[model samples]
Target: MQAKLRMVDAIIEVHDARVPLTGRNAYFEQNLLADTSKPHILVFNKSDLIDKKYRQPVENEMKSKDKKVHSIMWTDFKHKPMVAAADLIDIVKDSVTNMQRYNRDYRTEYNAMVIGIPNVGKSSLINAVRNRVLGKKGKATRVGDRPGVTMAVLNRITVHENPKIFLIDTPGILAPKAENIENAMKLALCQTVLETTLSESLIADYLLYYLNKRQLFEYVTEFQLKSPTDDIYELLFHIAKSRRLINKSDKDCKPNFSAAANFFIACFRSGRLKSDRFMDFDLLNKS
Candidate 1:
């Protein structure tokens, strides 16, 4: 990635909007952003999953925290009309043009490198911008629901024709530095890390703890619970029995708690537990 950085004109760092505070890659800060002249844009993807009301506040907080971020964008790659993608094109153009391009100022075309931790929509952003600018029908890069989809740095993809814009897609690079355990769990909760890296029950327990701490009990109604409970096993058992996820091999036909945990995690990921408006780092400063 450092080798490819020299050839690119700008940087687009994608992150999960739900985990804006903890989803960022520390490697980028220590390595990629070493050059202050580079135009770096921080894109908070999956913004649709979070409440829209917090958008401005989050932006303000990010700007105050990281002045190196030349621009900040909120995007949902799958959102129709794709206004964010198009607007991103404009921002990139202005950012690269206004900033010092090092030795590439004479170049007519713009090359931006899309980077982030796994599954934060780096490829999706590339595909969306490519489709929007070029009016292309298919994806310029591969996209998936899970992490580690793009395993390596890919060739430059053209997005626009005039002042021609191109995007370079890179594998999601996680920071190797040790992080706060709670913040790391937040990353897992937002699905930035692979699901298999942590046990489903463990992640589910953290989710329950987080939600309960926030006093957000919408999951109770979503899962048909009479009331909110602090116990992860009890919740999983209730969901398992309700959904009839049984251990058929067992003589007593016990509820499949593992399967139920997986289902619970899925519901949280899809934002079903919070009426499609969950934010992972809400009141982070206060907490």
Candidate 2:
């Protein structure tokens, strides 16, 4: 990743607006951005999932830290492609203008690198910018709902002409170990890391813990439960029964806890419940 940093003019760090300051790879500062004195802009994608009231605070809290965040913007790439594209270009231009150009000083064309954790809409955002800014109308890169979609770093692809802008899309990078268990669970819950990293039951347990702890209990009505409960087993059982997913063996019938848990987690992941919700950011809160 450090080797590639030299090839680009600026870096665009795309993170989920839902989990703005959590589960982000800590190495970005010490390695990529620090070693290379270039413009770095932070963009929060999936902005529609978060309430507008929280947007400024998220940026403010992040900026309060010691690290210099050139600029931050809230973007919903899918719905408002043109608006997001324009905002992205404007920020990049502003960042590049103020920073030392280094090797890129004499270059006529501009190259921007996109990096972030998995499934945070990196490829999708690239495509959105390309389609809108260049008047092109198709995906320049593959996009998926799951992690590791872009498994390797890619070469530069033209996003615009005239000033001639290109973007290099890199695979999502994650830390080897989380700062703590809650962060590890938050990353898994947000699907930034692989689902296989943790058991389905365990992720479901954390999901219930977070929702109930935060007092977001729409899940109760969603699962047809009388009230919220921390016991994941009890919750999944009711969810399975309510959804009519039952398993029967001879004379015995039982609720499918695995299926129910999978469904519950999938709902949260897919934003069926308006819940790509952020964790309570401890560092941001302290700042």
Candidate 3:
């Protein structure tokens, strides 16, 4: 953000709706807050994935603290290009216009930087916005599913009316070094790290605990998963079997239980398990 600030007039921070708090760069948020001169806009993307039950609570939480922050629920791929472009134009126009009206010659031309963490749809958002503005599709450089796909920042140009807008796309953020559980969880969920510091078994246990509390035991029971009698390892083994994650050993031709357990846990963490299990934020605060 600091590097892009030198080139841009304003910053639009895009974050995921399902994990808004987790989908932000701690460094950018802190540094941007300290520099009051750089006008910033908060955009929550992927509202389509949010559960209706939790949406109001999340919105209320954000609004209660920062009332000026703007949010839009982005969905419908067919119309997303137009909607996103219009929204970006509107935001930049309003922000820059006010600065100019106040005789702030320092901030002119409305150069905006699009910033966000990995897999939060930042590239997609930029492409959509550019397509609408240019009356043609503008390609934004993007990497694959792997973490740290964006190793270096790149600039993309968009023409709006008579002026050219420079949009700087930055690398996906890894959590600033922190030890707090909440921060850790946020980093783990947002970044594209292939291997997490937290153990897979621990994550699986947490998922189990969350599901049991939400009365979503049926998900576990659907596969006829057996509850662990006493040992967590045994439970994981059972989970692997239920999920049908088996590997035959080369030597003895035995099922590779360890490999199976890892596969199942990875699927659970990546949301492939179709579990709505999430760490209860409200419950965390109460406790």
- What is the C-alpha lDDT profile of model 3 across 103-189, one tens digit per residue? 446543557777776666666667666677777654665635555666777765563654546566777775555446655544454
**Sort by lDDT, best first: what order?**
1, 2, 3
Quality of model 3 by C-alpha lDDT: 0.58
Misplaced by over 4 Å in model 1 are 275-283
- Per-residue lDDT tens digits for candidate 2, residues 80-173, read 8789988898787667666777666788888889999899999998998888787887788999988899989888888878677889999988
RMSD of 1: 1.8
Which residue pairs does candidate 1 place in steric collision? none
Report the candidate with higher TM-score, 1 versus 2.
1
Candidate 1 Cα deviation (angstroms), residue 158: 0.6
Model 1 lDDT, residue 267, Cα: 90
lDDT of each: 0.83, 0.82, 0.58
159 Cα displacement, candidate 2 (Å): 1.1
The better-scoring model by lDDT among 1 and 3 is 1
TM-score of candidate 2 to 2 decimals: 0.92
> Where does candidate 3 stray beyond 4 Å?
67-86, 100-108, 189-196, 226-235, 242-244, 250-274, 277-280, 283-287
